[model samples]
Target: MQVKHGFIGFGNLAKAVYQGLKEEEEIEFAYFARSRKEADIPYYGRMEDLTAFADVIWLMVKPQDLSAVLEQLKTCDRAGKTIVSPAAGRNIAFIERYLGKEQLVVRIMPNLAMAYRKSVTAFATNQPENENATEIFGLLGKLGKAVQLEENGFDLFTAVFGSGPAFILSFIQIFKEKMQEFNLPGPLLDELLLELTQGTTLYFAQNQKKHSIEELIRNITSKGGTTQAGLDYFRTHEIGKHFEGILDAARKRSEEMSKNGD
Candidate 1:
């Protein structure tokens, strides 16, 4: 049987997911949003119509918009449907309050890498054993590395994986800024940075099983070398602790959102 997938909001994350999954033969995609978007899939003018047509409903709206969307969703006849939400800060219990305890609600934290099918996704659900929910969990695996986690673990997951890309790119930006001293064109600098990152990733992929990350760094560093000088400065200034503070701030915001529900 074909699985009908409906999205409540067709924003960037929703578009990334659709792009990642649209090639699957068994999934039929459609969406409803305030404004119609350019896409090959069907667009429903009404939320009720979307709910009725789909077997799985994706609540793809922002965290702030989730409550209003749920208020409308509660009015729809959602029996036998699965609710999948990727909105950060919102938990399964928050969803259950409106949809009731029996609804199969899947909460996920997937980065924007879903567009490239390389997302590291975190999954949690109210009904772990339900056949449809299990299938949804399996589907997440197709998109990327999906790990089932406790709801309480979601904040940290959001900090590391959900918001990780931006943090990583920020580090790359620092490199780019440093390279400006060479007077290279901005676009050329960006291309060089991309290649550097790709090469580093390839190296890690090749040797990760045999070497710990610390071991990999040690292999690159030599006695009284440039890498060692950088490492010494990094450690001496507690830069790693400062980076952890960034993640902690993001996690704290997620916790606050859970409490505020908006």
Candidate 2:
């Protein structure tokens, strides 16, 4: 049977998810948003119509917009439908308050890498054994690595995986800024950084099973070498701890949002 999937809001993240999953033969996609977007999928003018047409409904609106959207959803006949939400800081319990406890609600934290089908996604659901929820989890695996986690773990997961790409890119930006002395074109510098990151990722992938991350770093560092000097400075200044603070701040914000529900 073909599965109909509907998006409540067709923003960037929604677009990324559609791009990731549209090739699947069993799924049919459509959306209802404030404005129609350019896409090959069907666009519904009314939320009620979209809700009625879809078996799986993706609440792809912003976290702040979720409440208003759910209010509209409350009027829809949602029996037997699965609700999948990726809005950061919003938990299953928050959604359950609107949709009721019996609804199969899947909450996920997937990074922007979803567009490339390489997202590290965290999954949690109100109904773990529901066939629809399980299938959605399996579908997440096809997009990238997917792990079933506790709802409480989402805050940390959002900090690390959900917002991790921008954090990683910021680190790369530091390198780019440092290399500006060479006066290379910005695009060329970006390409070089991309190659460097790709090579590093390949090296890690090749040896990760045999070596710990520390071991990998040790293999690159030599006695009195440039890498060692940098390592010494990094340790001395507690750079790792500083980075952890960034993640902590993000997780704290998620917790606050969960509490405030705003």
What is the number of backbone collisions in each predicted candidate, taken in the order shown?
0, 0
lDDT of 2 by residue, 87-199 (tens): 99899988999999999999999987888899999999988888999999999998899999999899999999998999999999999999999999999999999999999
| lDDT by residue (tens digit), candidate 1, 13-130 | 9999999998999999999998899988999999999999999999999999999999999999999999999999999988999999999999999999998889999999988889
Q: Cα RMSD (Å) between model 1 and the true structure?
A: 0.9
Worst 10 residues of 1 by lDDT: 253-262
Which residue pairs in candidate 1 have backbone atoms (N, alpha carbon, C) closer than 3 angstroms, thus clashing?
A: none
Off by over 4 Å in 2: none
Can you give the TM-score per candidate against the true fold? Answer: 0.98, 0.98
lDDT of each: 0.95, 0.95
